[model samples]
Target: MKMKISCKPIAAAAALLLGGCMVGPDYHRPQVNVPATYSELPGWTQAQPADADAPKGAWWTGFNDPLLNELEPQVAVSNQTVAQDYANYQEALAEVKVARSALFPTIGVTGSGTRQRASAGSTSSSFTRSVGSGAQIVNSGSLEGNVSWDLDLWGSVRRTIEENSATAQASEATLANATLSEQIALATAVIDLRTSDANIDLLQATVKAYEHFLEVVSNQDKYGTVAPSDVVTARTQLENARASLIALGIARAQNAHAIAVLVGKNPEELNIPHSAAMPTLPTVPVGVPSTILQRRPDIATAERQMAAENATIGIAVAAYYPTVSLSALDGFTQSPLGGLLHVANYVWSLGGSATETIFDGGERSGEVAAAKANYQAAVANYRGTVLTAFEDVENDLSGLRILAEQADALDTAVRDATHGTEIAFNEYQAGTVDYTTVATAQATQLADQQTALSVQQSRLLDAASLIGDLGGGWSDSQLHDPRNPDKPPAQPAAASAASAPAAQTSSATGQGAQPAVQ
Candidate 1:
């Protein structure tokens, strides 16, 4: 009958072990819209899904610029912004370790020593004691250890660990996003500087042509063949051209300073030499629109946040159930040091307790409600982020297309303007046109040349922006996922713009080439 009574507690423990199920809803990837092919990508073949397994392509190399190759890698190593994100990732990694510790029992030790004397007249439990040497000296010592464990019968600890792991994964995505942002920024700044250099070159050449025109005008005035005002107009045009040429230095200097800061150098520490050849625009082969979710860090971040929020629901639900606590104590005591290790002095005990929240004024209910609301919000945010990413890629594709057409038309205008300038100069020599006419033609030619150069600059900038909009080669896999990597297999080249169908694309895979610019 006593054995039958003891079996009851064992039956309860068995029930607890078998009945455990995580209380909250398990995470499932939220449904969101993903387009078939980019509306802006006309006449281009979409890469098959198998292509995503190809190496993540190097988009910057598509530009074919040597200088960019040298500068872009520096942002990862020395840039302060990237460094800050790296440190943040490390902190998240540490937090994962912290959350995991709850799964194990905790141990503590205690020790004490004491000395005392008992009165000679004392009695033991009302029984008379004979006086021995007037008083008896006594000494005692102890060493003890205790163990306690909060059994995860309700899955609270498991839920907490899941929450932390998801949060850490989100942090990893943020770091990748920051690092990519800075790299693209540095690349854009360099493009701007190169553009400025090209424009300055154009203006300087105009200045030289204006100087020659001024010489011809002065000779005519000396011979009294043209009026004094004619000489004054040519002199003004030459001076204006020189002023414009010199003013461009300000922009060039400032852009150089900006590049210096990006690479973690002082403003004056770096200098880029003038190069006439701009990097060739790589045809950015924007594969299909569906893959963008795999490579985008911001999107990855949002999805992870949703996952983290989902775990909190389980944690809140667990709070409504009882918590099981188990503890054990073991110690040794002796009057003399020699007897401390003997089993005769051993002391031990084991016990288990359970606590239930019978009433809490609806606090637990409110908490559960709040957790659900937060999860819903995260889902909305994740969907919104996906939409925004698709829009970004589309914008870049459209921009590059239009800019290319504009560049061709401007090239024709510059050539016609040059012809007009030559004809006006020949008319002046024949004395059929005044110096003012030649000056006007010269200004028109300079203006057209400047416009053409600016278009070239614009084309380069749009290309760089396209690369940025496409995710700059970052993968979702780079983040820490101890139990399972959330992202897809490494993206094929140019997949920095990659996204997975099931929210499993890595943030750091796919070093393959990007979409080609048409």
Candidate 2:
């Protein structure tokens, strides 16, 4: 018997599969309401293109603190949180390759050898049928190769690839966000440590002044020129001053420990010597609110998450279509172990099959609806992230503006209080006033000085926070796609346009339009 097979039907089906329609909504970034300008921008200094002193490289360098500059860079490399995010990003990148592998065919090879003993009288079809009753040995060998492909006629594999790629980009943005946050934390800790040092110096000076006042009061009490209560009051004031100076050590040590951890070190490993220098407050440039969309890494992370969720909808919609699969097998088989590769023993087959679900109890519909709802949620989250970024920037700007005015007032009050304290002490020595007046004046001077130092610390803290809220020199354009990590990342506008739903309509060759990446 001879069998004849026709390839025309399979070829025609392949053409139809290639030109099949991908039934689902393509991804488009949802519209968002963005403000034209920030409400707190009025008092902030706007950066000019030609300003030579504007912060150029790392924003932390603008503070001009040698220790901060040295420590801040280490956060990106050594901070445990940042290292964990980086590892997650690498895993996401590998997942993209895993998803893309579904787009191509799978190839496999198999080889086998078999030997068996069979009774000769079992089923004889030879010329001398039913002549022999003894057992016979048979040897057989086979080798085969197969190729199978689950054709992506409805763009399911393409959608899966798109989803994984977007996830990878989101993970990359997450890594950036983590690094920026740790760096900001490091800068803030250093500022606190320096403020503690400054406070310690101020308190030490006040303690010395209090001791001198105590000495003068004790001498007068011994000569009967002052009341015995005056000696008690003087000793009480000096002891209180000493106690306040000792309390400052707690804050300074805690701040140092926090800085060490921020830079990925143990508290005991890093020893920060007492520095007389304070960090200079840097002028953070406030741009229009729209710029935050591109500058903030958290916003970028949210946007990429939206794109990934959008692709999931397409994947779910694909399940509604029938699945088509193509397969091919080629090999040689022989009854004996000799000449297995001969043309007489060659065998080949080409086949294709399609399966359509007749009944699924509405499972497919539920999946599609769930995917769409998830995408909508992602869109809402993205918009919320953007709104929150604007809020952060506005709050930082307002705090800095008001704190600057308060700093000036405190400076003037400190000088006047110092002069008042000197006059009160002289009046007490000349017997024109009681020792109580001297004690009150000294307390006022110390209070005013401490308030001034506190105001300075607040201003420096606000500067660091403002810089961080401004994105700490990060940009969305730095988010690299895993597929082409060496190439520059596409701009947000261009990437959105490329993956727009309107542009996706024309592609049906199982090669859907993809998100833009350089």
Worst 10 residues of 1 by lDDT: 499-508
Query: How high is each candidate's TM-score?
Result: 0.84, 0.87
Cα deviation at 342, candidate 2, in Å, is 1.4
Across 1-518, the per-residue lDDT of candidate 1 in tens digits comes to: 00112335645764575456778888998888887877765443343333344323356776778878888888878889888888987887777777767766666777887656667744232222344787655556877777776777877777887888888888888877887788778778878887787888788788888888889889888999998998899999989888887888899888888888888899878978887766776554455676677668889989999999999999999999989888777888766444665778788778899999999999999999999999999999999999998988778767766676676688888898899999999999899999889988998889888887777777777767766666665657555574444654443444333432111111233543233343
lDDT of each: 0.74, 0.78
Cα error, residue 306 of model 1, in Å, equals 1.1
Best by TM-score: 2
Predicted structure 1: clash tally: 43
Question: How many residue pairs clash per model?
Answer: 43, 0
Q: Model 2: per-residue lDDT, tens digit, 1-518?
A: 11122356545765675566666787888878888776654322333221234453488887889998899888888899999999999999999989877866777788899876667754332322232457666667888887787998998887887889899989998998888888888888888899899988988898899889989999999899999999999999999888988999999999999999988999999999999898887656555577678778899899999999998988999998889898888888876656778878888888999999989999999999999999989999999998888888777766765676676688888898999999999999999999999999999999988888787778778777767776776778778877676788765453322221100111233544221100
